[model samples]
Structures are given as C-alpha cells and as structure tokens.
Target: MTATDPVLRALAHPLRLRMLTLMWPGPLSAAELSRELDVSHALASQHLRRLSAVGLVELAEERDRRGGRERRYRTVHGSPLSDRRDGTPLLAGTLAHNLRERAGRRAPDSEGVTVDGELWVDPQVWQDVRGRLAALAAELHAAARPPHSPGTVPVGIGVMAFALQEEARPEGDGRPNPAGSGPG
Candidate 1:
C-alpha cells in the first residue's frame, strides 16, 4: 500500500481519525486507544489492523500492566509519496479515489460552486475574497482547540463559500445563467 492510499483510507472513518489524533504524539497500547476513543477493544484492534494492512501503522511488542508482552501499533510517518513531487502511481490513484469520493458527495452542490464559476468573476472582488480565505485558513489551522467537554458532540460544520452572479446576456434572452468566481 502507498502512503496516500493509507492516509486517505485511514481518514475516511471518524473513529480512525480520532485514533490517529490520539496516536500522533506517540504510540499507545490497544486498550489505551480503545479507552481514549471510548470504543471497544475489539473494534479498535480491527481498525488498527486495517490501518496496518495499508502500511499506515506498524505493530510492536510492548509490555502491558501485568508485564506481559502485548501488541501495540504506531503510525508510519516516513512516506515518500507524501512529498507531492514523488507522484507515485499508488499514491496518485489513492488520492484520486479519495478526492472522487468527496467530489461525489458535493456534486449536487456544484451548480453554484463549480461548473459555471468562470462566468461570475468581477476579477478584483474574487481576488480579494480568495486572499481573505487563504488568510483565514492559515489562522484557523493555527488556532487552538476548545476545551473538551464530558461527552463528544457529533456536530460537524462544513463551510462552502463562492461567488455567483447573473451573466450579461444577449437581448431578448430571459435565461439567467450563474457565473462562478474565485482566486487563481
């Protein structure tokens, strides 16, 4: 399995994402992972197995509470394909597949955000918005996380912003076409 393939597949599941976030700092035992994620040990092990199969993680022997050797998994961060220039076929296809899945979900919302976006440009305005968005993305990533609550919230926020406007049409044509615009 390629780096991108595993990264994408590992991230596809919410539980897996949580597991990854937990493991990012260091390796943890399966029981510790399950407890942290509030999942059953069997389920956590299963996810870890899937992750390991894709080369995203490696299992190691660790002594548990009773001083018995137990299996533990850790993420494999040294992936060449992760460096965009490598363009390995496996990584490319996995990335494409992952993106395609996300695209399929947004296809229905494409009319306003894609397809006809070229027509909506008031070139200057789009540039300004794009700059602001880029700044926001940087700042957001740099922001600190909120304090954890006693229980997890399933709430998810998806922000989609784009410009849409009516195109200047020929005389007597009543059709209103949407134009889309964004930063280059």
Candidate 2:
C-alpha cells in the first residue's frame, strides 16, 4: 500500500490510530470521541470522516441531538489491518508514535515488559513465533474494553518482526580468522 492506499493514509496519523482503538469495542460519536481524546469537536469529526471515507469505519447509528444529527462510528474490524507489505513503513511510523506516547504515560512503579531482537532464526521457528504473536494480538483486541472502564488496566503492546534480505558479504570478508588456530 502506498500513499494511494486510503486506509493507510487515513490511519497514518497517531490520533486516527488512537481513535480506531477507542472504537474497537463499541461505537462512539464524534463529540464523545472529542471528550475522550481531549480534542475539539471539529477535529474529532474530521478524523472520523477520514476513517469512514476509507472504509476503516462505518456509521453505526445516528440520532437527533440538540436539533442536529449525531453519528456514531465503529471500526470495520476489531483489529484493523490492510495487510499490504508496501504499507509497513507507514504503519511502523504510527506504531512508533503510539509507543512514545504510551511510554510517557507509563506508571514508574508498575511492572512492564519491553524487548527487542534482530536475530537469525530457523524458518520454522520464525513461522511459529509469528503465528503466536499474531494470535496474542487478536486475543488482546478481543478482550479490549471501553476506554478507562472500571476494574480494567490500560496496557500497551507493539510488535514489529520481519525477515530482512540477506546482506552480501564484501569480497573475501568471509575468510576465517587465522587468530582462531588455537583456543585461548
């Protein structure tokens, strides 16, 4: 997916990603989103329109309020993904922004987990790990609750794993070191 991918373009913003998560469990009107996200009504509405335009969200309901119509929108899927390899960079940037914001809100005294890896692994191992990671993400989305609900804790998880192209060794760089003739 390139800039031409509407879903990618719509969700390229941090706020739009946040809005999508907020709507995963249920529908929310623009005004409600504004209050929950601490943004102006117009801004929330504009983002909602963008999401809807891309088919990432659909109008769930509409009602008359204060002589004006109020529209509620829900995500098309609990976990939204265009699943295009070309869109990785945009999604990565969104995830990075989200992680930074969530990290700042972390509770210093509370336990948290963070890990990074760039290792070479067997193909089967990589496949199994990828499947488990995806399942865990789906499970989390399934268990999501409305924002700030009682007895629920807010947690953030970001996963980015992909196989990189094998780098070509420079001429003669692969030769074994002569210094390894004997164990030290």
Candidate 3:
C-alpha cells in the first residue's frame, strides 16, 4: 500500500498499532479495550471506528448481556500488506514500539526471534533466497491459529530482507586505522 493510503496512514498511529496487537488473538469490545489500555470508552471507540472504516477490523459478534447487546470486534487480516511503498519509517516506528512494549514486560528472548546476517551471492541467488524467505513467512502466518487454551498469547512475526550498501572510503587516505588494518 502507498503511504498516502488512508488505511496505511490510519495504521501509522501508535495507539492504533497497540489496539491491533491487543485484538489480534481474538475479539474485544470497545469497553474492554479502554479498560485494558487505560483510556476512556469514547476515545477507545473513536480509534476502533477509525480502524473499522478502513476495513482492517470488523464487528465479529454481538451478544445480549445485561439487557443490552455488546459488540465485539476482530481483526480481518493478520499480516501486513506486502506492497508497502514509502512507509518504512512508520513501520519501523511501530515495530520499535512493539519491541519496547515487550521489553517492558520482561519478555524473554525465547519468546521471540531475530535474525540478522549478511551474505554475498549472485543476484539470482539472492532473489531465490528472498522468495523462499517470503514463502516461509507466509506459511507461518497461515498456520497461526487462534489460541486454543489459556496461557497462550498472540505472537507477532516479521521478516525483512534487503541488500546492504557498502560504505565508501576516502581515496588516497593516509590516516592509519585505529581498529586495525589490511586483511592481508
């Protein structure tokens, strides 16, 4: 999705991102969301309505409770759009917020995974590797079913691959390197 898309812009907010994360595992009412996020019901409802407007979330079910019908909302899509354009900064901020939240909760490294590596390969090989990584991500996302029992929490998974740019060095530099020197 383009950066100008309303849906993408709407999702760039930190509050909305947290709301989506809270609702990822299942449906939650506006009141419930407010209670969880420590916000007013009206404020929570406003954000929920905004999310609904873009079709990211939907009214899943309404039940009669205490002489009134309570509406529950659920996320319709669990994965981020792959066609994002010019939204990297927003996405990176959201991810950082998420990571910070998890860290605040003292989440162990075992609860999540991070992969970082650099490889030199032919362009075609890199393309194939990227495709395989995308396929694996899709497969894992598809296999993510709702929590079946207590003690289970929703897990967020993200995959990104890009070629790194080489740093340029000054030509005919006479300064000696402090950290060390020639590979030879």
Candidate 4:
C-alpha cells in the first residue's frame, strides 16, 4: 500500500481512534489499551497489529509484570497515517455521523458533552488560506530545529490540522455552526 493508504485504513475504525487516544500520553501495551478503551485483549491486540502493519505504530519488546517479553506500542512521529489518501473523507464523515448520533441519544438532564464545529470559507479564498498555513508550518519546522535561545520555551505540541469541503445541505437544516463549535 501507498503511504496514505495505511493511515486511511488505520483510522477507519473507531477502536483505532480510541487506541491512539490511549497512547497519546505514552506507549501502552495491548492489555492496558484493552482495559482503558473497554475492549477485549484480543481485540486490542488485533488493532495494534493492524496499526503496526501500517507503520503508524511501533511495537517494542517490553517485560510484563511476570518478566516475560510483551509487546508495547507507541505512535510514530508526524502522523505515520496519511490524510491525502482515498476513502479518508468518507471514513471521517462516517465517524462524525456515528458520534453525533450517539451524543444525540443522551438525555438532556444528564451531564453529557457534545463536540461540534464547522468552518465556512469563501471558495476563492480556500486555496490561498491552506497554502499560507502550510508555509507557516514549514517555517515553524525550520525554526524548531535551531538551537534554543534565552527566554525560549521548549515544548511538545500535538496538532490536528484539517479542512472540510462543505457538502450540500437541504434548506431548514438544523446543524450547529461549523466554524466555531466547542466541546460541551
């Protein structure tokens, strides 16, 4: 498979996203992921295997409490998964729809949270906006490699950057604003 194909496939499953979130803090074993994500150990192992197959995760030999070698997985740098591959858009939309549906089923009186956001931009400005963001990112990467100066802050940042092309919606649709939504 090409570079982006694995990313698309790795992210195609909801369980994989949960796995990534679990590993965001640090490397985790299949047992830990299963417990944290509420998945069976076998299921967690399968997910980790798939992610490793795509190079999105690296498995290291680590000792379990029993002192036997067990596999631990960590996320690869720079999103070993690709966003430019085919089927990514559809997969993303499906995941969004499922999450929204799940949120909508909760009782209003319950202390539930919902995340929603949308961005509306003029078609003519889209390309220019994206190009400017890319240029800025490249500049940051170039600067990040240089030696730190006095009063500089060294930090690890996790960034999720993406754009959405609006799909046609029927009149009187009642979805929340796209450009400025936050976790509830």
Among all candidates shown, the one with the greatest TM-score: 2
* TM-scores for every predicted model: 0.42, 0.87, 0.69, 0.54
Q: Which tens-of-lDDT digit does each residue in 14-53 have in candidate 3?
A: 7887787677667889988898888999999999999999
**Sliding window of 10 residues with minimal summed lDDT for model 3:** 175-184
Query: What number of clashing residue pairs does each candidate have, in the order they appear?
Result: 3, 0, 1, 3
- Per-residue lDDT of model 1, residues 82-148, tens digit only: 2334333434455455445446556343443322234455679877976786666445433423224
Name the runs in model 2 displaced over 4 angstroms.
1-3, 78-83, 174-184
Q: List the residue pairs that clash in candidate 4.
A: 118-178, 118-179, 119-178
Q: After superposition, how far is residue 40 of candidate 2 from its true place, in Å?
A: 1.1
> What is the C-alpha lDDT profile of model 2 across 159-181, one tens digit per residue?
77787775544556755533433
User: How close to the true structure is residue 118 of candidate 3, measured as C-alpha lDDT?
Assistant: 83
In the range 1-184, model 4's lDDT, one tens digit per residue, is 6455566767777678656645644578988888866779999999999988877778654776776767777766464433454675656664665465445555556663343446666656767866775666556544542123466543332223367655756555776545544321
Instruction: Score residue 183 of candidate 1 by CA lDDT.
Output: 20
Report how far off residue 5 is in candidate 4 (Å): 2.8
Q: Looking at candidate 2, what is the lDDT of residue 55?
A: 90
Ranking by lDDT: 2, 3, 4, 1
Lowest summed lDDT over 10 consecutive residues: which window, candidate 2? 175-184
Candidate 3: regions farther than 4 A off: 1-3, 108-111, 117-121, 132-158, 163-184
